[model samples]
Target: MLLRLPTSVSEARECLAEGAVPIGGATLLWAEWQRDGFPALAMSLRGVPEAGVLGRDALGAAVVLHRIDDRVPDVLRLAAASVGTGAVRRTATVGGNLVGSTLRCLLPAALVLEARASVLGPDGVRETDLSEVTAKRPLLLGLRWREPVASAYRKLSAAPGGRPPLTVSVALHADTAGPRRLRVAVRDGYEVIDGGAPHDGDPDTALHTLRQTALRDLPEAAWDAVAAQVAVVLRAADDV
Candidate 1:
C-alpha cells in the first residue's frame, strides 16, 4: 500500500484529488483491509498540523477521541468517551467519527453543538454545517462551534458498556435578552428539536415536538426516554 503523510491542507487536497483515500486513525479501514485488502493509496491526516488542533470552540479533524473528554463540553466529551475501548478511543479521530458509520457516537453532539465543518475538497476548504454536508467522504479540516451555556448527554444501551442503540445530546444556549434556546439531537436519524426551552409545566409539548420531528423507526418508548432526558438537561441548565 502506498502511504502519503501530508503536513498541510494543500498537500492533503492534492492527495485527495489524486484519489488517495483519507486516513485518520484508520479505525474504519481495518475492517475493509481485512475484507478487500489495502487500498493502492492512502493519505494520513495525522501529520497535518491543522487537523490535530483542539481549542475551546474548535477541534481539528484528526483530534484523537481519548484526549477530548477533559477539553470539550460535557455532551461532546461524554459522546467521545463512549465511542469505543480505550485503545480505539486513543486512535480514533474526530473527523473519522463524523464520517464513519461505525464511529458516529459524536453525530448527535455535533448537531446540538451546531458544529460547522471546514471541508477540504478539490475546490478548496469551505465551511458547511456538520449536519448539512452531504457529499460522501469530503475531506474535513476541522469543526467549530459556539459554546453553549450548558450541555448534557445520555446513552441507553441494552447492557453495561455495550453499544448503545440510542444516544441523546441536549444543549441550552442563553439568548441575550430572551428565553434560553434549547437544542436536542438524537443519534437515531438526526432527530432534532431546535427551539425555545419547553416550559416547566408543559413536558408533553416537548414530547410532541420530538414525535413530530423524529423521522425514523424510533419507538414510542424511545421518544419518552429522550424527552425525559431533555427535560432533565433543561432543568439542570436552569439551575446553572
Candidate 2:
C-alpha cells in the first residue's frame, strides 16, 4: 500500500485530489485494512498541524480524543471520554470518529451542536452543515459551531466502559428574542435528528422515540435502562 503524509491542509487536499483516502489515529481504519486490505493510496493527517487544533468553538479533524477535556463543550467532552479505553482514546481522532461506520463516537454531540464541517472535496474546500457530512461523507478538515447554552450526553451499554450500543445527546441554543431551540440526536446506527425536541420538548418522550427507533433491535428489558440514562442526562443538562 502507498502512503502519503501531508504536513499541511493544502497538501492534504492535494493528496485527496489524487485519490488518497484520509487516515488519522487509524484505530478504526487499521481494523478495516486488516479485514479488507489497504486502499491503493492513503494519506495520514497526523503531520498536518491544521487538522489537529482544538479551539474554544472549533475542533480540528485530527485532534485526539484524549486531548478533549473541560476546555471543549460539555456534551462533546463527555462523548469523547466515553469512546474507548484510555489507550484507544489516546489513538482515536475526531475525524475518524466522525467518518467511521461501526462506531460514530462523536456524532451525537456534533449533530446536536449543529457543528459545521470544513470539507475538502471535488469542488474544493467549503464549510457545510454537519448533517451534510453525514449524507455526503466528505473529507473533513475540522468542525466549528456556535456555543450552545446547555448540552448533555447519555449512553447505555452492557459493558461498564468502551463502546456503547446507543447514545443520546441534546444541546439547547438560547435566543434572546425567541424561545430556546433544542436539538436532540440519537445514535445507534443511522442517527435520528429530531430538530425540535420530543413532545414539545419533553425529555421522556424523546427517550420513548429512542426506544421505538434506535433501541428497537435490542432486548425489551434494555430499553428501561437506556431510558433511565437518558432521563438523568437530560435533567442534568437542563440544570446547566
Candidate 3:
C-alpha cells in the first residue's frame, strides 16, 4: 500500500483529489482492513496539525477520542465513554467516528448532539448539518456545536463487550413553554425532533412511553425485549 502524510488541509484536499483515501485515526478502517485488507493509496492525516484540537465548541477532525473529558460536554463524554476499550478510544478520531460509523454505528451520538460539519471538498469549504454531510464522505476539517442548554446520552450493549444495539442521545434548550429545542437520534437512523417535551428530561420520558405504544403494534417477545432496552437507554440518558 502507498502511504502519504499530509501536513495541512490544502495537502489533504490535494490528496483527496488524487483518489487517495484519507486516514484519520483508523480504528474503524483498521477493523475493515483486518477483514478486507488495505487500500491502494492511503493519505494519512497522522501528521496534520490542522485537525488536532478538541475545542469547546469545535473539535478538529483528528481530535483523539480519549482527549475529550468532563471539561468539554457531558453528552460528548457519555458518547466517547461508550466506545470500545481505552486502547481503541485512544486511536479513534472525531471524523472517523462520524464517517466510518457505517450502518447501525455510534454516529447518532453526533447527530443528536446537534453538531455541524465543516466540510472540505474540491470546490471549497461548506458548513452543513451533521446529518446532511455524513453521507457525502467529505473531507471533514472539524465538527462544531454550541452549548445546548442541556444534553445527555445512553447506550445499551447486548453484553459486556457487545456492540450497543440501542443508543439514545438527547439535547434540549430552554424556551417560553419549556425545553423547546429537542433532538433525538437512535438505532437504524430512527430520529425525533421537536418541542415534544414541556420541560428538561421529558424527551427521555416520551421515549420511554414509546414502549407501550410499540407493544400495541407488535406481538413478538423480541420486540418487547427491544422496547425494554430502549427504555433502559432513554432512562439512563435522563439519569446519567
Candidate 4:
C-alpha cells in the first residue's frame, strides 16, 4: 500500500480521483489489510497540515475536526469520545471516522447528536447529513453540528473478557415542528423507536421511549436482556 498525504481538500480530491482512498487514521483499512491482505492504494492525511485542527468556518459555527481543539458542546465531545482510546483518539482524524462510516459503527449517539458531514467530492465541497453521507460514496472531510436540546449515548457489553458492545443507541430531543427533527440511531441492527409528542417532563423518559422502541424492534430470538440494563443506566444518568 502506498501513502499520500495531501494538505488540502482539493489535493485530497485530486488524489481520490486518481484512485487513491483517502485515509485519516486508517484504523479500519489497517485492520482489514491485516486480516485479509486486500490490495489498496492508501493515501494518509497524517502529515497534512490541516488534518488535526477543529476550527469553525467563517460563520463561526461549531466545527469538530480531528485537528481542532476539543472544547465543544455535548454532541462533538461525545463523538470525539467514540474514537477509541487516548492514543487512537489523538491521531484519529474526524475525516477518518466520517469516511470509514465508523461513526455509524459507534451508533445511537452520532445519530442522536444530529451530526453531518462536510464532504469534498468530485463536484466540490458540500454539506450532507450524516445519514445520507453514510449511505453514499462521498469522501468525508469532517463533521459539524449544533448542540442538541437533549442527547445521550449508551452501549451494552458483556463481561470484561467478553465481546464488545452488543448494542448501542443515541437519542436526541428535536423541535416540535416535525418528525424530521426527532431522531434515533442504533447499532447491532436493533429496532428503532421514534418519540413523538415532544414532552418537557424529563429527558430520561425520552431516552427510555427510544430504548423501548429499540427493544420492540429487536428480533424475537436476538433480543438481549442486557439492552434493558443499559437503558436503565441511561435513564438514571438523565436524572443526574
> Please, what are the lDDT tens digits per residue for candidate 4 over residues 53-103?
453321111122343433444434554565557777665555555546443
Worst 10 residues of 1 by lDDT: 192-201
lDDT of 3 by residue, 31-150 (tens): 788789888899877667757767556677887788878765566777787777899889887778777766424465566556778887887678887666665777777777775555
RMSD of each: 3.2, 4.1, 5.3, 5.9
Which portions of model 3 show Cα errors greater than 4 Å?
A: 31-37, 103-106, 160-163, 175-179, 188-240
List, residue by residue over 1-240, the lDDT tens digit for candidate 2. 899998977888889889998887888778779999889999888788767778768898989999998777888999999987999999888988887655677887888788889987777779998777777778888898888777777766656554446676777676667655666666654444444444345766665555565335655544554455455555755677
Model 3: lDDT equals: 0.63
- The CA lDDT at 152 in model 1 is 83
Clashes of 4: 9
User: Residue 104 CA error for candidate 2 (Å)?
Assistant: 0.8
Clashing pairs in 3: none
- Between prediction 2 and prediction 3, the one with superior lDDT is 2
lDDT of each: 0.76, 0.75, 0.63, 0.51
* TM values, all candidates: 0.84, 0.78, 0.72, 0.63
Candidate 1 deviant stretches above 4 angstroms: 132-135, 159-164, 189-208, 215-217
Candidate 4 is scored at a TM of 0.63
- Please report how far candidate 1 places residue 158 from its true position, in Å: 1.3
TM-score of 2: 0.78
Best TM-score among the predictions, by candidate number:
1
